[model samples]
Target: MAQPDVPWPLLRSVEALADAPLAQIADRLRQATLPYMGSSALVIFTEDCTGRPQKKAGEEEIISRVSITELDSLRATIPDEAPWFGHAEIAGRSRAVLALKYAPSHALLVLTDPQPLESTPTPGLEMVRYLWRIAARRIQEKVADAPPSYLLESRAASAERLRVTAELTDLHSTTLETLLAALRSPSLDDAAARSTVTDLAAKALVALRTLSDRTTDLVEEPVATAFERLREDLKPLTRFGGVEVEFIEPPLNGRALPGEVAHAARAIVRGLVLTMMEEPEVSRIRTQWDCDGENLLINIRDNGSGTLSADAPSIVRLDRRVQALTGHLQLEVMPGWGADVFVTLPLDPPTRPAGDVAEWNLAARELEVLQHLVAGRRNRTIAMTLGISENTVKFHVRNLFKKLDVNSRTEVVALAHSHGIR
Candidate 1:
């Protein structure tokens, strides 16, 4: 007699079973197989670390009574010549036992109705073997096709992305360093510094666009167009400070940048101008800019008293901001003559776009908390680092959660990391 055919839909169901936890998959297998066998109980077993066949699924009572040691003993009794189908009386009831090796390393045993075994036995045995093979193959296939766990995979990907981001950040820092070096040089005149600033601004804008395009997908529209605006904005500082600004390559229209970075850049420039204004009798200031593949170089110089000390509080604060974003800031103050401030910022903003107010509208202090949160610091640690009380930290955290629409620390960290906050 020919064996019954297997259901194609049942095989297709295996595809959806992939990526399920092992326990769920085993339970699914038991449910699928039990109906065909007319069995009240089903048990699936796999080898454990100790070389014992461990029961993976079935009724607890049935599993407890079925011993792996006894099964091994029974297998030993079956000779190589013994037919795969046999009668087995266990716990007083006589049942049909069918055995088949599905994979090279795995075996299956089915215990089923006794009535069919006594009549038309061959087809029943063949069908049982076929079903076992299908089940085993499906299980292995599902296991092999499992998707990666999001928690692990996402974190690893984020880490790799951050490393690449840091490298790009270094390019901006190098640009600042070159600019600062030129500003500090006694020999560079107003004309030379102005030329350097213009060139540096143009090149920095290109680098910014390149970095922005490469690292983030959610960049602001205005970022691509703000390069010229930046140069124009900086022009007044040189002019008013008695510094001549030259554009070797005029600033180009680049993509809109994150509002925060652009705002911060403006703030830094404003701060530099304010610092310069504190001194009188400074006659000439020259600012220049250029790009050399790896970095954007900006040079600003003045013939005034270079009396700015690197250790000043304002300088230290600027340094902290630069260092936090993996950039660099240098200051040179030569007494009675001139003061030069050089700042480098990454082409990519240190923070990702927090999106419109609807998505992640953060207040100033909340943004500060987010920055620390991304560093993987604990609440108490963040409180200490920020010089706030633990209670204040909790308050900020609660507020941050509400603003960012995140519920947990982990989610906040993921969000922060994605946006380049840390």
Candidate 2:
């Protein structure tokens, strides 16, 4: 028998989403669903299994107003691989919540407005599901067709860097143009013109520096490069303190960390090193970074009287900073032996609380996949355990990756461990 044909509108919508930029995909999805949802605001968001939002594209005010707790609650009720439709009070008003499985991501498509669910046709739910499937498939295809994750991240970093460079250049030119224009205007006195120029220069200088710092944060630095930078930063501190610093290098081929993480890590280590050097008897400090699949394991030891208290002000400040990144800091002060500082900072964002796992809005099967993943089971092993095909296991794995905001199995496991999942 001949197969039935799909609708042209559905096909066209999927094509548009496939060709759209990543930032534009949410808007396109929202537009595609507006006809059926008629939601005053349509929010299409991707959340991890732990219910943490990874990326969202939608109306700013609506997105900002939506309670994360509400999303988490809705996520808890939705079944995976199925569409959920129901009425719930959101932002102090009743609205329809349609949660669905968008492959490689889970979507909570919410509708709020002057139009109520009772006013909309029931067929709209089916249409929403159809559109979701198309969008999900297109997203999966795009990801599959893309380069390796690292290269993609690196390219994104480079693009951001270039964008900032352009912005700075334009700002410089604009400031010059403004000053030149002011100089030529005859309405203002010389003193007034000079004052205007001074004000503009001050503001421009501040703006330029702010933009530069933002761009720096956006850039991705390889762990090796970050380590080298740390070494350079510590040189003056070490030389002045009369301390010899030793840095044991990790494999440079590992995945790179985000600029913020790298910078924070460097600063923390520098602080610890400086603290050790302050002791009159301390002369040597040793540091090492180990990339063990997921977390960056840091070990810093110093040759000093082991009387350093973990509660010391310097150690306390470093501890607070590490905790801010969802990392752990431990001090092994052997009294008479040198102190050992062990820190575990996740390469990705730390996992949500274990109880929040249910809030991640994962389907039953995906939950199973996540369990196996946390147990360090390979894809084939998981497939066999679940009596599912290897390809199916891979499908779940990819979706898990999107939810977890990670690119590798190691990262997933590490994150799971961090959240006490395993």
Candidate 3:
């Protein structure tokens, strides 16, 4: 005799969620939970995947419009592991919602317009919670073990997010300021109306500023805290990998790290240590980080045979991640002293490639193409992402080449970096 709750259908649903790719995991989760609970939309936000923090699926109108601010606000209200069920602001309006937070990673999941498939809501909620945990951990592991492609895409996405946020902050702040100014004019006839409008405008301005600050917090982590998280990420390895690891903390007063930089830094160090541990002679490893106001300097050394090969695939991958951030990696293999590695990550983005937009004399489309090029996206990827044809991308690329006076993609990328076109 078998329990009905443990049927093959349930097993298949779990399998689907576990095996889905990063881009499709959200959709898979939605499908998996459909039997237990139905929702108009589903949103998952986890800082672990800094490149694309929100993985959403469901009603296009709802999922498409949900903002990080709204989600963050909702998460603030939950305050614990319990599933919060009630009306909350989502996608610019209040809607009945079921919200849950994965405590360990501080990840959030929201189901809009939720209804239990079975009469009892308890079973469905329990099952959905179980599935969400699996998906959350999967995201964490995938990001930690991210391939080179994921790393490149993550960096590009992160930069675009920062750029967009900056523009929106500036735009709204100006608009709100103007409104306040107009409402407070001395010549206004109705004192009550003027005062009410002025009060509203002032509050709007404050909220705009607060949202701007929230965006910044989402993108950056204090240097000290970033370093501490890195140590925590490596705790399991140190505990069982049979290696004595030392952590040299960075300055508490150091600048904050951009979300992508923090994520990459932790991944880079984890990869390096893992590679070092593979060498039979490796017994101890030391890692340290320092901030000189302009860059994050990382030093990782292992007391092994000094035979760690810089050409190792793992090292090469880490190097790409460093260079992607406008950073540098140096590997010094002293025959018997063990391998010492140094990584330098820039604190500020590369200066916009062209000091003045007019210097490039390129059309708007060409500039867009160039930005994607700098992100290490292939023309095909750029085309798909931009929703334009590959041939069109080529047209823009050729124009960029002539305008920037660079012949090869490598030269174009190098020139852009040199000019600070991050």
lDDT of all predictions: 0.51, 0.65, 0.82
Q: For model 3, which pairs clash?
A: 351-420, 353-421
Poorest 10 consecutive residues of model 1 by lDDT?
46-55
C-alpha lDDT of candidate 3 relative to the true structure: 0.82
Q: Which candidate is the best by TM-score?
A: 3
Query: For model 3, what is the alpha-carbon lDDT of residue 128?
Result: 95
Q: State which candidate, 1 or 2, has the greater TM-score.
A: 2
What TM-score does model 3 achieve against the real structure? Answer: 0.75
TM-score per model over all chains:
0.31, 0.35, 0.75
State the weakest 10-residue window (summed lDDT) of model 3.
405-414
Tens digits of per-residue lDDT for model 1 on 121-197? 33544444555555565544432232222222223233444454566577776776677666666776687766778
lDDT (10s digit) by residue, model 3, range 1-422: 98556477777978987787787888899998888999999999888776577888899788768888999998998879999999998999999999999987899999999998777444998999999999988887787667654655455455555665677778988898888778788877888998888888788878877887887788789999999988888899889988999999899999988776788788889889999999768999999999888888999999888887778898988888788777899999977779999999887665543455577787888888888988878999999999999999999988886776443464466555555676
Which candidate number would show the highest lDDT if scored against the true structure? Answer: 3
Per-residue accuracy of model 2 over 36-93 as CA lDDT, tens digit each: 6666555554422111232344545555466544664566676676766677766555
Per-residue lDDT, model 2, residue 278, is 79
State each candidate's clash count.
Answer: 39, 3, 2
322: Cα error in model 3, Å: 4.0
